[model samples]
Target: MKKRRVLSLVSAAVMLTGIVAGCKSKEDDKIIIGGLAPLTGNVAQYGQAVDNAVKMAIEEINEKGGILGKKIDYRSVDEKGDPTEAVNAYYSLVEEGIVALIGDVTSKPSKSVAQKAAEDNMPMITPSGSEESITKVGKNVFRTCFIDPYQGKLMADYAFKKLNAKSAAILFDTGDPYSTGIADAFDAAAKELGMTVTNKEGYASGSTDFKTQLTKIQGSKPDVLLLPVYYNDVALIAVQAKQIGITAKLLGGDGWAGVQNQLDEKNMDVLANSYFCNQYDPTSSDPDMQNFLKKYKERYKTDPIMFAVLGYDTAYILTAAIERAGSTDPDKIIEELKKTDYDGLTGKTVFNENRNPVRLAYITTFEGKKEKVLESYSVD
Candidate 1:
């Protein structure tokens, strides 16, 4: 009877040990990251591109060996390009115990998410949000791209110095902080550069008809027309400007990156002199950029846009911070990010006090068969 009791106790101990080991294995295998982007709305294409790049990065990181020996698990929520939806997505991700977050792609949604994440002290990085105010919210929010003010100044300076435009008119979207910020900065810079501003006009978001605005602008007869708005509005405005026979040279901020794709080929002819600011030129011969281009093409089976590169770099920076911090503490990660002077695919990324990237901006124009890089500028 004594021998049987001892054997029974030993068997129970072994079973308990196995159970604990299984639980430990499960815990060791899980690492959750959060993503928020507009997966089904007007900006869905860009959002989807960022999401794809992030997923690819996570896959590659896992293949080699994930951060701290655990595979990365990501949960992505579609913000649908709405501010409230973006806030809710952040809240949900935070509640789910995510270690980090990427996105809220556009400016407005990103701003909303950044504010909430700051309040919650979460480590969040935006792939393409460009409003100047985004990084000003707090130390917790970091952006992979330059702000709209730099982009606006880039175009304004280029217009005055390179294009030799003496006077210009501004057409901006009132509902978008991104557009408004760029327009404000461009107007200021143009005046400082001795360019006369003939007229300034504003339109609501999602407005298709700009004939009235264009009519007023045409009457001003400025040397250039600046449209610091997104692709949808840009397309409509370009088409309407052509319809109204306004022949002034058109210029735009970084928001114009994919506008040509949305415009009809015939309408694009009207914008032959159009130019915009961007962060990266895929045609760059920089060795880092070349390798990124090759790897991105190999993975996605296509060329990457500025946003894709931004998304990829954002992931790499955040992962590097994690590695440097040696833990998932938000405060520690923010400190590491502040110290980031790492060479990324875009360029050398360093953060200002506001957590915005101090980087170079490229001025690009559409030529017959390609987008030509006109110039590049770095912010001090």
Candidate 2:
């Protein structure tokens, strides 16, 4: 097998060598991978979790003698949860001739990179981006987590069939494709499932007070309140909901993955019996997941969120693809990635035509400030 070492002075210079030679680099002597995430800003939790987990996966893979006898070189950038910054990061990585990419943890930034990968035919995979349109950008794009459409419908079905919730209310951010997509999908699914959508309200993420919207939903007296946004918004709403005496069961998507890490016990008390879709069940009995959970807690001094598990799975999937293809060629990796069926901490992942994984999603609920696995369900 070909083997090369990255020079500290100009690690990515070798990738540009092939371009100067006029042919695409089929497989280099060394393997390189790139990642993008918003490591700072309000959404930093998701990005930091993904970054740490991806790094952990890379370390484990390297220790095992890496794919085809060459250790993998990885470089990740902080997108700061901004689309413009994410695109800039993508170009820098692309110039380095990375074999594959895992990144842009959020939907918007993920979309930015996926678009470039489509135009350039570069292989890219997102760890936690749930916007359904992400994969639509390019055939080379993929994701480790379920999409918003499926997740929305999955939760809607859960509310109707499992919880027997007759009426639902939704509070989402219209400006965000992630939030609106889920709200739209849930509304549609609720109607199809014969469940009543008592009230649906939209708000901007910057708005601190939700009294205007919450007041309307409170009057509806819905059995459940769907919060398909990130943890920051979810926490604020949780506090507001309780202050307003709203006792409805709260439901959310993977965006609610790391609630406890952000909010205190009293701030999260409103969601005592609430639940949200997650990428991995930290409390699952699955041996692989158990091992991951244990190691993650030990390494991070805390729990692993869904983004972290998805990021780890993204690294595993890329390495598995490289192993199956036996080369760093993007085309070969894409071909092998489509056949992926590896059991990960998240679950068994199989990529469909759109490059989205078809897998089960776990639901997490809190018990006395402790997040616990409620159950897992399939979209099928």
Candidate 1 residues lying further than 4 Å off, grouped into runs, are 1-26, 285-303
Per-residue lDDT of candidate 2, residues 84-121 (tens digit):
77886677777666878998799888998889888888
Error of 1 at 292 (Å): 4.9
For each candidate in turn, the TM-score is 0.84, 0.88
* Candidate 1, 56-102: lDDT as tens digits: 77887888898877778877877778887778667666656677889
Itemize residue pairs with steric clashes in candidate 1.
none
- Candidate lDDT (C-alpha), each: 0.82, 0.85
Poorest stretch of ten by lDDT in candidate 1:
19-28
In candidate 1, how many Å is residue 66 off?
Answer: 2.1
Error of 1 at 147 (Å): 2.0
